[model samples]
Target chain A: MLTQRQVRLAWLLVLPTLLVVVLVAGYPLAQVFYWSLFRADIAFVEPPEFLGFKNYLYLLQDPDFRQALWNTVKFTVFSVSLETLLGLAIALVIHSNFKGRGLVRTAILIPWAIPTVVSAKMWQWMLHDVYGVINILGVKLGILSQKVAFLARPELVLPAIIAVDVWKTTPFMALLLLAGLQLIPEELYEAASIDGATRWQQFWTITLPLLTPALVVALIFRTLDALRVFDVIFVMSGVNPATRTLAVYNRQTLIDFQDLGYGSAISVAILVLIFLFVVAYMRTLGREALR
Target chain B: MRTWLRLGNRLLFYLLVVFVVVYSVFPFYWAVISSFKPSDALFASDPNFLPLPFTLDHYKNVFLQANFGRNLLNSVVVAGGATLLSLVLGVLAAYALGRLPFPPRNAVLYLVLAMTMFPQISVLGGLFMLLRQAGLFNTHMGLILSYLLFTLPFTVWVLVGYFKGLPRELEEAAYVDGATPLQTLVRIMLPLTGPGLVTTGLLAFIAAWNEYLFALTFTVGDKVKTVPPAIASFGGATPFEIPWGSIMAASVVVTVPLVVLVLIFQQRIVAGLTAGAVKG
Candidate 1:
């Protein structure tokens, strides 16, 4: 049933995209795998020496690598979970019929729209231990006896970074959930109310089950973004290892230390980790979400 | 009892609305106000939340002292160039994938999705080498070329949804008229998908404008560096001395234009964003 001309036209149009993708992504990714096997440093004069899986072997034993991995997972899990709960609350509230609803919806986009670096910089100033408004307000309200160095403290830095990520991303999650909320028919709610169901019962019985598809998609999307978080933490955390996620750590290895082979190995590890995440997500959520 | 319960629910609803608005809007508000505060007032003991004793020195300093004008120009060129390139390539690809009933359509789409999710850090070494070899390292075009990795996926995916939503009759009519595929796309479909193009273009521009990782790695000199890196590199006279007010001014200046544009095209942008995930 297919015409040869149509197929040819399709390939012609799609070929450019494939070419660009392969040049920028696919081939570079292959190059990364190749580079991962050699001990190459940008600073060195000699050609790279092949080490096979030695870089990966050292990576397994490297505590810094493990810490960065832990930091990435912690940030992703905590931030995404917080964003989900807060995003759900926001979606429910914004979905309600109210005056100024449109303004509230647009206002929430401010955080999401601003560049990540700008948001991080804004918080960097606000989290200042001495002159910060957060501490000023806290001291005024008697919540703290003195100012706490938010970014400098090892224990608090990751949480502080997570707070920034949550602040920036919750709006995005809310919008997706809001779209899902709109898809639920009003007649179902009306019928439930007419059947003597309480508000809580209606929500538990009607809203959540219907919203699962949207929720799953939103979770996966946010998880994918969070797993590669860089800008907010990089701009805010200064030189703290406590806040160094996988992307930030990888940048350090590739650009700062100039250890090309080790850095490429880390890159390979990250891809494998992300690939596993996508596979697990598919297995659990089923392919219906993709469609 | 029922009246009290109803009153409680009403109060809770209003409270939640207030919390949401305040939580989301307060940071930008703080940034705007802080940008105008004098250095003395910025670090005052009882800091003035209002823009009292306002000063334009921060804005003046951001441009005069920081060489930020050059960075702004660089951002405009890079983001603008990337947006235009992505739109061109994206429209062609979107036309094929969305309408043409091509073999391997599903595979190509998934390939695009995977690329969209491809970690930039993974490709940092490879891209660095490629850019250097092309003699484009530390140049605007390099950033634009690398940006294709993110912007292309977004424009194609969103425009695919837009193209698919169009009626098949239009294309068929063009075919009946003996129009070439390019002619039909240019003469018939392009006019109809104007809003899609604008929405996708604006989103891509904002993305490239805001990108930090590629921009940071690809460019070094202020002659080539974009706003994000320029702003990140800001420091005071001494290591301990931080220019909080100047950084805020840069943030507000960079953000206000985007916020205004987003406000104007909110609906289209929202539709474009959800069209991908919901349809997928």
Candidate 2:
């Protein structure tokens, strides 16, 4: 614990990795922060002017940015809640002793394994106005009077993107919860059973309490990821700045519009939000997951 | 009365299982079957569940003309290179953190794990500026380095668990036998954590292989493009006329490797997926 030589050796070993991380991650992070305060043009920059807080102030007044904030929050809350419930239900069902449980567990992972772009495209085709299977089934089953343009209608677009997200991510949630479920000692359940406890009572007393850590971890991960949603919305709704979340909008500002200062400010805001989530997660995870 | 209740429970469980499977697997099956049918038949009023008059024209076009193969190759090179590099670097970092007692060791670990949660959006602006300046923009090298943002953290986290699970005495014994630290690591510790190595490597590969956002933003030319963006907007060239058959064929081709891996190592896949959640 106290040898200088040992410490030196350890540092030497870690030096290369640290260098790579700094070069790859640290440098870019610093550059972005630097760029966010200047009038950096993509095409022509004779001498970039320093414009501190101007970009952020402009963004605050921007209607599109405000709408994006609201959309991100709405998407995260709805998607995370639904994914958790569905994940828990699926986990519980599979946790019980059943035939072909192995097969079922593997089947569940198919959605999570498929690349997000493929799944988003699949749903896009299914939600197409005229010939989508979803509309076909909806009309046949009398769910809708006529074909609905799921991606076209502004009202339905967000929900449609959320649906694709939920479809793709619920399996991931269920897999994590299933691992948590598997950890609870069978002895505790058996002991409760011998005490004449009903299944519902046993689950309340034993299962849910022990599952809190995993549930919180899953929720935090999913919610944080969802809040920065981009691909599904970008692919399905065509990144019109109306359906943009923080991520999609940030892309528009930097790449499409080349507003580096404004984009960096948005990025800074997102970084702060993520930092808050990590701290909250660390508190709930109680130092174990950190290990 | 107890037997009757048990019977009902069994029936309900089976029904639920059936429902989950159908809900999960139907779309994949739909994509596969639809890839074979012609476009006119796809929009038919009374649709047949199976592909009637099956054809290989879709696969033919996807391979012959769509340049999907080039995209697939680029993804393989980028994903494969990133995974390999991260595995080597991450393993070293993980080993040092796990074995060596250094100042701020715990702090470093926490920082790396926390970085895993940093949404890509937050860093995109900064990363773009830096990369463009460094001449890394619109290059495969840039994509690989950017992917390390997720892969390195993920690899280190998974390997921490693996390194912890390994017995210290084995490596201690090797060191006592006069082997150098590097020798002990390469010859002794690594071989023992074979399964962990495979699982971590596989997860890293999959994440990089499927990544869409960075690849989409960074790589403009087909020479450096990856599969996700290519497949995502396959119809953009001719917006009105979707090459549905070719798109489905490409999806199938891209998906087959992952599907096969799942079938072969289903248990390991499940274990790997939830590596962070459950532990002994």
Q: How do all models score by TM-score?
A: 0.98, 0.95
User: Which parts of model 1 are misplaced by more than 4 Å?
Assistant: A288-291
Q: How much native contact recovery, as a fraction, does model 2 achieve?
A: 0.62
DockQ class, candidate 1: medium
* lDDT tens readout by residue for model 2, B69-99: 9999999999999999899988888888877
Question: Largest lDDT belongs to which candidate?
Answer: 1
Model 1 chain B worst lDDT run, 10 consecutive residues: B271-280
Candidate 2 chain B has its poorest 10 consecutive residues by lDDT at B271-280
Best by DockQ, which number?
Answer: 1
Compared with the true structure, model 2 gives a TM-score of: 0.95
Candidate 1, residues A159-200, lDDT tens digits: the string is 988998899999989999999999999999999999999989
Clashing pairs in 1: A290-B280, A291-B280
